[model samples]
Target: MSSETHEFKAEVAALLNLVTNSLYTNSEIFLRELISNAADALDKARFQALVDTSLDGQELESQILITVDKQAGTLTIEDTGIGMTREETAQNLGTIAHSGTLRYLEEMQRARAAGESSGAVEPNLIGQFGVGFYSAFMVADEVVVTTLSGKPGSEAVVWRSRGDGSYQVEPGSRSQRGTTIVLTLKTEAKEFLDRWRIEALVKRYSNYVMHPIRLRVIDEQGEDKDPEPRQINAASAIWARSSSELEDSDYTEFYKHVMGGFVMPGDEPFARLHFTADAPIQFHALLFVPGRAPADLFQEDRKALQLYARRVLVVENCDTLLPQYLRFVRGVVDSQDLPLNVSREMLQEHKSLAAIRRQLTRKTLKLLAELAEESADKYAKMWNEFGSVIKEGLHTDGGQRAELTELLRYRHVADTDDGLVSLKDYVAGMGEDQKYIWYVAGPNEAALRNSPHLEAVRAKGEDVLLMSDPVDEWVLQSLSEYEGKSFRSVTQGELDEPAEDEDIDDKDDDSDDKDDEAKAKDKREPSPIDPLLNLAKVVLGDRVRDVRASKRLTESPSCLVDAAGGLSRNMERILRMAQPGTKLGASPRILELNPDHPFVTAASKISETNKDDPRLAEWVEILHDIAALAEGTVPDPAGAAKRFTKVLNNLVAG
Candidate 1:
């Protein structure tokens, strides 16, 4: 045997050590890695043949043949694809140029900056890093790769590595224009030597690979009959099949296969969108919104969507398919138009891939809109699990914001009696003069229903949509208007209405006499004790922006409103979780007190007599506490508790 020794870079050695010993939890992924590398090689050969007509006539039977020798305790994968020269093998295997270890490190650094905790080293990340060939070290003690380049006069080469810091590449002899990988399995990895086990893995992970996968195995014909070798994988695009032929069970089965068979007992996909596109880029996609949100969906360092090329799964949980807002989506996007050996760096810059991304995003939004229209109940259930994500899309994707708004559902006063209605339905029942869509955001239905902000709208017989979801504030902030009508937050802005709607008719001659008598009686009535209300505002100036007699407050003693443009209490919590330790600018709040309420009336009388009384201070504190609770903010618990105890002690003493 001829051999030329080569030394690996320090980082390459470290990477190899990580892959061989620390990276992967499942060793079977090595087969998938090999298959993907072989596919890439075949793709390159096809691309080369297209450019050079001389290689067109070459009988390039692009397929993978896996041979398992139990007696020899070895597994070999052979591919009829573009091979490597001696120098190429030495550089590719010994150095980390082709592999994305450098890029992976960069990504880790970026992730860390974003405050994500990347706990364990990932071996399956090999595919993402583009050095999938090295994954063989996870299961094999030694890997021997024999290759023959497609170049007219290129010499064949053999590269051998033993999970160490160095490898050897030498001139080799091979009859075909391809590569073959022989894995000398470790004692613990002897199961890979079983034909059945190897065949199952090929079907499970690499079945969608465009190349036929043949397994050398013994098929029993009879009790005394010998076994025979055969092909195990279908090697076709499963998604290209017609939906008419695909049953729900079939789709579910495929999902389980792609998702690593982690299907929960009663869980079903909330929705599925399957379609094909050919214009900008040739692609087939099967997207599913899981019935339950994954435990990792909210995890700070959650993985992204899955990405595939030519039916061969490329990246698991690939975030590139859609924006992070659509992370709950699960599916495969098989694009034949994308380059097979493209690096992630290249993918980010590819024009055609970007176009495909735009198309897929639009298609997904359309599918969700269809679901909302087709079955309101089912769609509501989906919304309960993933509605926040859709709202997030509305907040971020301005181009599709209108469509997302149409798909939005909320509980209005009318619908609340039954619970939740779409904007379209609410718009359908709007009065002729109703030009603006009114919505109120609060902590819950009860709180929103009791909100003093709704009084003016209700007095005019108008229905205000109650937005209780935590995402509602952010959604409405971004979605300022819809269908040419402005969206008005009942709690924040000035109410504008036509003069006719606000005007009250003057009393007639006979009624004028009674009105004059009533006016004389009202003039004789005592003025409201405004001193106490002013005292309350002065005492709580630090906590509140303003205290005023509220025309909107009907049943409630007090209510709260943002003094300026900013996020509501609910939105503050959501933002805090997404960006930990991020300081947000504070917005002052208006405390609106109802003059007719007994608490306020009593405080008014108390302040008039005892302007300097400590009890008046206590009453003012209590009023602020009530308003803070209504606004869903935490009040000064100690001060409020002391005031409450004094009130109770006074009642007991009386």
Candidate 2:
């Protein structure tokens, strides 16, 4: 047949050049790319057959076939799936369909010019940009594609291309309605001709592709002795199997396949949930809490699950199936209920997918709860590795706050060992009069343990949770209360009133009903530390909202507290770091001084006798600086040092 020659589009040529030269560091991935395309073609055919019973490919077995000719230095991959005609072949293979191809080419060129060995673009972009087919050019000097459309009366076509700027398309003869690809391997790519290497690559990347991949290898003499091809893949959807029919090893193997590689090769999954839901929407899920988080767990676009439709792999790294906070999960979710032609845009608005997501999240949380109940040590270890991530859910998932709160574990002032206590345990251990669940957040456990805010709570023998993670402040804000007990940040609000002693419950109604005159009389009387508090407020001015005698502090001279509804010191620090050059300290905090402390008593005497003494102002400044230091930050390190030096000099002179 006469062939029509066509020059590739500029973007396609550039992409071909990049792929053949240095786009992928791992050359074996070309096989994976080809295999993935074949699987997708099969999926399309199966879905089409469902819609149109007369589709020509429906009679063919749904499978992929691989044949290697070592003597000829060529490899072939054939799929009994949907195929393209001459025009479709030319358009699909000769041009770039993605709009970002130009941008991608520019980025690659820049990276190459900068002496980068690999492209700067994400590896997945090759697939997303609709040029994954070109990856075959990376290993083969020449490639030939023979295809016949699944549509009735469609003509067969042949597309041939070398690692050059042009390709040729012509009429071809094929009785089957599918595509066949043959690659003339480059000298260096001959390693792919090895039967063992081909098997390994298939198992690594396409083991769970949902289509049987059959292999037939020719020996050095080019004679195939095997009568039939051997299936290389398990070919069964692991998630679709009944949970009772699967074992731990089966689950672990599937986890490795879904995660793309042997991540933490020595570690088993921390936990897994395998179940089928047939009620609201039929779906199967096999979710895993990885033994440890992937290295890119915190990356913004990192995806942790694979979405499938009718056992056909749809989205390879599907992020929409799980919340961002739960990106540590790894598994596959398959449902025939979803449209086989579902798009990412449609997945965003699809009510069925949303319901599936919600159910997956609840099931995951429930799995964790069960793990914690059945195995305490195991749960604690998982919490240690992943608690910070789970805390994010408390901040972002309001509907799951109660569940996430139950999942929370924290180190407290009473923890003798490095153990975490849950909120339930903390509440159960609370004193009868303890009105709030107290917590203190700081840079670390050491800093939080030394916090003056926790001094009174500790004095009362009530434990306060030590929160050190950056996300803890936001989490506490979202979880304002748990089990009817309001979460009170010790550093942000008034300290708890002293717990009343049950042995001393005698009181008279006359005293409770005292007249307004008696109340006024009580208000007029000033305590001994009132002078020190009043003087500090004046000297500090608006830097502090108010200066008051402490019901919280037992030993520290002074400490800062967020006003009625202002940012705590830890929260302000987080914001300042997150948004630089923004005004954030506009809201002043209250300064509370310990009434019975020696420094306050002596300072009160001096302020009462001589309110204008310059030394008293210096002492007040010193008090404020000390409070800031105790809060794990120095407002002005230089100023604080200078004042401290002056105080040291004055003391030396005296």
Candidate 3:
């Protein structure tokens, strides 16, 4: 038989170039992609054999055998499954039939039309294009694929392609059915020829594939005449094992084995859910919520959950296991029922898979709730690391939102000094007529604790949950209500009347006298003092949409609260960092003051007696400046400095 080469189609050339140069940066992925394809072929064959056992004559033995020859610089992946015909090989490989390239291109066009920049949409485009097979070009200079269809009398075919945009197809003879991919490694990619390297990559990327993945590695013994190739994969699904047989350390090790990192022993998982279900689909899953959120969890380019089939690994990072909100979770999910050749698009639409996802999501949330109930300390630690992500679920996933809400923790009046408390605890501690779940959002625990907005609630002995996490405000916005209780931001809107019995009233005549004295001291007299407040508001007009006397102030002379439909100070700071150049709305805040405070009383009296005193006017300006600082806004330093000097001169002359 004579070997020949042929030119590739124009699009094939572009696809090859993309795969070799830009598709993947890691060369080891070529091994994973090939092994996954082999496992898929074996799975298909096993499915077919169940329908017609006579096709192979012998009982179907499904396995993926990988051979690496260091001296020859060649790596081979073979499988025994329903193979392909000459036409099938031509369609699958010679072109991009199985690759999701067309769909990827369509997605790219759609993304571009949706106003996404080219750079922003690039990394998210994967799998839909059939070019994954061509990713072999990332490491290999040349590739040869030999496939024999399972049907009797079907001739085996070999398809060869160089890293360049061309390929050739020819007929070959093979005794067994299935496919084999041979990669002639390039000089720089010789590491792939090492037995250890190949084994490591297999464990890293294909450990969860459904069929047995056998690697040809030299068996080490006391005496060796010649090295014989042996299988390397674990060949069994870890998820299928009983939970009792596994230790926490064992789980951590397995996570490291699949995740490819040294998982520390002290690193406790945020939440772990291990279960099996045969109903909708046969699957065994061990999912873990990391004790800490990954830096990439909120990154625009999010990684997917690792996917496994049976015990052998199919896809290293599979996004089909859970929704995007659960991206912070890391683990393996092995299913025996799903089709091996299921496409990404199909995975999205697959009802069985959807059912599986819903079940897994609920299981994960339930595990978290259990953690919170069983060990509040550990769960609180977990919330510190991943509460924001769970809060995200509370916002986006409506079905599980209620469950997620119960799992959420916050700093409330009752638990403020103690630590974090759950919504359940807050509800249990609620006063009889408390209709709304109240919370205050701020930069930190201290800020929220000192917020004037919580004064009235605290006075009534009601607990106001403190939301300090940068994500808290958004989470609250997404989850408008929980468990029939509407969530209200204490600082954003007006509060309903306190429980009737808890009303503030003077019990004695002396109490009445004290009340009158306090009112006289605290109340800002209606005089030129009002105009000074108005002048300050006008000077800071658009910067602050509105400014008014605050009823919430107690000890602090002044504080700022978000105007209607505006972000809290903490939320604004967070947004400023996340999206640069995004304009924030001008929120006029209530300039709250403690009416009975000595400084306000002194200022009111001084302004009244010396209406034309420039020093008194300067003092009035200083009071507003001080108030702005307490409210977390900086006054104009230059103006503040000038006013300070005038006040100092007046005091020195007096």
TM-score of 3: 0.69
Per-residue CA lDDT of model 2 for 286-384, tens digit only, reads: 888888767788887776688765554556687888887788888888875664321221254578888899999999999999988898888998988
The whole-model lDDT of each prediction reads 0.71, 0.78, 0.67
Candidate 3 lDDT over residue span 1-654, tens digit each: 455676766577776676667656666777777776676566556554555556662464788877776656777888886788876776667666464334434765796789863453232112344666877888888898888888777888889888576788888877788888888888998877676788788777666565677767423332322255466677656678889888887787677654447656667576677888988788889887776666677776666666555454555667767766677888878766555442221343567777778888778777877888899899888887776777777667878777877888886767646488887777777789788788887676775676667777777777888787777888877676666677777775334423212334533434543354354335445543464455546555565544455556556655556643445667777888788788875445555445556766666566556555555455555666776665455658788877778778878999
Off by over 4 Å in 1: 1-65, 70-73, 78-204, 210-226, 229-236, 300-303, 342-348, 432-435, 443-446, 493-529, 539-541, 564-588, 602-615, 632-634, 645-654
Model 3 clash count equals 19
**How well does each candidate superpose onto the true structure, as a TM-score?**
0.68, 0.69, 0.69
Better of 1 and 2 by lDDT: 2
**Clash pairs detected, candidate 2:** none
User: Which model, 1 or 3, shows the larger lDDT?
Assistant: 1
User: Lowest summed lDDT over 10 consecutive residues: which window, candidate 2?
Assistant: 497-506
CA deviation > 4 Å runs, candidate 2: 1-64, 68-75, 78-205, 209-212, 216-231, 258-260, 263-267, 342-349, 496-525, 612-614, 642-654
How well is each residue in 341-445 modelled by candidate 1, as lDDT tens digits?
433222445777777778878888888888887988778888777777778877778887777788787778755564668877887777888877888876677
